[model samples]
Target: MTLLGDAAHPMVPRFGQGAGQAIEDGFALAVLLEHAKRDKIPARLKAYQELRLERTSRV
Candidate 1:
């Protein structure tokens, strides 16, 4: 299974991005999944990770 937001990268309370990041992760994953083939799940997830990691790391 794939992880998202706090589950993937929990942050200190001061960051105040737990919910927002979760939402962003879910939305991005959903969009990717929509166009992804069943056999391409791994690739899709990797894409999601790369996309979110770049954005979340800055938080």
Candidate 2:
């Protein structure tokens, strides 16, 4: 459940959205780090994975 960006989606790096997902991951990680929270790690990661799974899979 440790999702990290569009590693699943893997866009063409066009429109600069490819790395956007990674940036979002970074932000999310930052928030969790700052709060020392781990409760939602698995769920959040799973959600991120699901979000990018189809989109990146097609790309």
Candidate 3:
């Protein structure tokens, strides 16, 4: 399973990025999954992680 939002990148409540990041993560993952082949789900999930890790870490 994959984590998103606060579960993925918990931050100080003052920063207020938890919901937005989660939404963004969900949207991005959804997009990736939508275009991925049935047998490529794992690859797509990895791609999702790679795609979000850098950005999330920065936040």
List TM-score per model, in order: 0.89, 0.46, 0.87
Give the Cα lDDT of each candidate: 0.90, 0.62, 0.89
Candidate 2 residues lying further than 4 Å off, grouped into runs, are 37-59
Clashes of each: 0, 1, 0
Candidate 2, residues 1-59, lDDT tens digits: the string is: 46566664466758887687678666655655564457866666665556656655554
Expressed as tens digits, the lDDT of each residue in 1-59 for candidate 3 is 78888988897787678988988999999999996778999999899999999999998
Per-model root-mean-square deviation over C-alphas: 1.2, 4.0, 1.2
For candidate 2, which ten residues in a row score worst on lDDT? 28-37
Relative to the true structure, candidate 3 reaches a TM of 0.87
Please report how far candidate 2 places residue 38 from its true position, in Å: 6.6
The most accurate candidate by lDDT is: 1
For candidate 2, list the clashing residue pairs, or say none.
9-56
**Model 1, C-alpha of 24: deviation from truth (Å):** 0.4
Q: How many backbone clashes does candidate 2 have?
A: 1
Best-to-worst ranking by lDDT = 1, 3, 2
Ranking by TM-score: 1, 3, 2
How well is each residue in 1-59 modelled by candidate 1, as lDDT tens digits?
Answer: 79997999897877568988899999999999997778999999999999998899998
